[model samples]
Target: MSSALAQTLIVMPAFNEEDAVAGVVAEVRAALRGVHVLVVNDGSRDDTVGEARRAGAAVVDLPFNLGVGGAMRTGFKYARAHGFRYVVQVDSDGQHDPAGVPKILDALQTHDVAIGARFAGEGDYTVRGPRKWAMKVLAVVIGRIAGTRLTDTTSGFRGAGPRAIEIFAEHYPAEYLGDTIESLVLAARAGCTIQQVPVTMRERAGGTPSHAPVKAAVYLGRAAIALVIALWRPPLTLQPEAGTTP
Candidate 1:
């Protein structure tokens, strides 16, 4: 069926993940009911769209690959337009656990945005060598800017409430890994309360990670650049979110 009206929507952004997308979709469907699943097929030159569709998810095909940030924005646009009060983003690579999906959404009850922090509470996700150091640096920088303590600032498993849906749908960042820090900054600046819930990250089910080998260096460079942009961004007077005054 097409985009059905639902209270909560799960958005999975995918690319060249024919093998992984179907399983991820299945797990999500089994873990959560009454929530529509939409997979943004980022111009995959594979069977990602077909597999996702076959596994019972509505699929949206992009003309070209626009990275995770772009795919996620597409999902947010749908959520805002379709009257979804809650939106959860799940990774197609399967690093994000289906069990943690509910935790993120549950945390959104009291907070404007809920992040499944892989290093929060009882997590053990690893960031190796220089990557670990970079993550720590980003944690301090982003946490300071967002005015909240953050762990696993790069984790993508997150849930957003209505106002967050509105803000990101209209003004999402297009930076690499902006899905983490930039999105949080946008929400926090918009007066959204962001909170991190403990969650575990697993190894990717299939395909190589987009940020592998030399791409890791690129991730670091772009994160550094995006950090500067977030720092310079002035907070805007956002509309009321979380039932609080703006």
Candidate 2:
């Protein structure tokens, strides 16, 4: 039983989240039993590594801050190498409620990727001005391309099955919103089952969000270009499955 639990890895990508990493890791442990927790400390200048380790999570200290996508990519590679059957991502900044991770893991019973969507319903997550508009636009564009509606294109709380873990290990993006946006499109194109579940988010455990207003605008433009490019790309190396998880 102990050995079997080793196949599931809960990855937390952290940068300057010292204030939140310990509590977040603790919450994950409390919420999910027997799952291995890994903290990918992305060159945090603070005590993220020390705190996460002290909180009883395995720590992978990156040489530099690789952003969320890059840090998560590294985590996926580790999961792939270690033969983890599932990878559930948790936000180190405490925005993602650890209790919600089980929902994603459970969804993976039928879906290849399960996203904890803040806007799926029953959540207080909302942005203002152009960012909100961009999110709505992205939802439509991605919904059309993915053949399903996805309310939150920027939520980092997600889970991956074996195949997704393998693919993302090799080619996960590392830019602003790169982890959430690119991963969704790639997973969709791969013909993997994708799903979203309603989840309420928390205020950041600590540190600022990546989506500052100025950065959000630049990211909006860049993400738009990327989304268009994704339309022309062929499906991923993994075989596409027929039908999807509702």
- Alpha-carbon local distance difference test for all models: 0.82, 0.82
Clashes of each: 0, 1
* Per-prediction TM-score: 0.92, 0.90
Model 2 agreement with the true structure over 1-246: per-residue lDDT tens digits = 334345679999998888989999998888778889999999989999999999999999999988888999999999988879889898888888877777787778777888899887767778877678888888887766678778887778889987788789987877556687877888888777788888889888688676566776665687787676665567677844336332
Range of the 10 consecutive residues with the lowest summed lDDT in candidate 2? 237-246
What's the lDDT for residue 236 in model 2?
A: 78
Q: Candidate 2: where is the Cα deviation over 4 Å?
A: 1-6, 217-219, 232-234, 239-246
Q: Which stretches of candidate 1 lie over 4 Å from their true place?
A: 1-6, 217-219, 241-246
Which residue pairs clash within candidate 1? none
lDDT of 1 by residue, 14-75 (tens): 99999899999998888776678999999899999999999999989999999899999999
